[model samples]
Target: MIELSTVYFGLLGIALITYATRLSGLIVMDFFPLTKRMERALDAMTGSVFVAFVVPAFYKGDIGVKLATAAALIVMFTTKKILLALTAGVLTAVIARAVLG
Candidate 1:
């Protein structure tokens, strides 16, 4: 059995490491002047990172998850609003799961 404190400390350590890694990237990038190419690469990287996180889940998800992803994508494309898309997706997943269950 795991103690709660152990879980909390482990999560804290992970969060700190994550923050450090992000901060290090920003610090390192500051040393170099940004070129047009670098700016484009950075812009592309954001989308790639988002896709990297989302693709695996989409691939392995069940029907509810698929529906949610579809809903989010449609909302995102139509409204171009991230927060609205996310809300639509979450609501879709909840409603889908409840109805299916």
Candidate 2:
């Protein structure tokens, strides 16, 4: 039988491993030289990761949440107002939740 303390330590170890894996690129990438192709690949990877993170949130989300977030993103892109965009997004989510529930 696993002790509770052992389970806690196991979970903590897994969390640490996950964090380290994510951070390893940032920590180690600078040590190596990036070729021109590598640079372009990195740039494309960055955009792909950004869209991958954001797109699902929009498509899989409720209509209100998607609309609110899309509006906030558009406002941010057009006006370059980070705070306002974030506020709008949060407010939209809250309002959507309230109304939908």
Candidate 3:
């Protein structure tokens, strides 16, 4: 029972809010100068996100997770390719869970 006008206005509101938020970030960054420490912190933030995701798995995950992590590390060290290693690790975990569980 939703009307077209309602959907249109809802989408327009979302677009306006998203654009304003992104534009505000650009405006603030333009006015500020990035220091060396700030640059390093920003760089580390990227890896911190991934580490945050994996750290929890190590703490509470089953044997499948451990094997997957070890496989991922081995592939990363051997091939030096992150995407391939991640895919392999995920596939390994899926297969391990299917077989073991």
Candidate 3 C-alpha lDDT tens digits along 8-57 = 99999999998997787578777897788988997899799899998997
Q: Considering summed lDDT, which 10 consecutive residues are worst modelled in model 3?
A: 21-30
Clashes of 2: 0
Each candidate's TM vs. the true structure?
0.69, 0.65, 0.60
Please list all clashing residue pairs in model 1, or write none if there are none.
none
Ordered by TM-score, highest first, the candidates read 1, 2, 3
Q: Model 1: per-residue lDDT, tens digit, 3-92?
A: 999999999999999999888767877787678898899899999999998999899998789999999999999999999998999999
The model with the greatest TM-score is: 1
lDDT against true structure, model 1: 0.92
* lDDT by residue (tens digit), candidate 2, 1-101: 99999999999999999999899878777897678898899889989998999888778888677868877998899889999998888888788878885
| Worst ten in a row by lDDT for model 1 | 24-33
RMSD each, Å:
2.8, 4.5, 5.6
Ranking by lDDT: 1, 3, 2
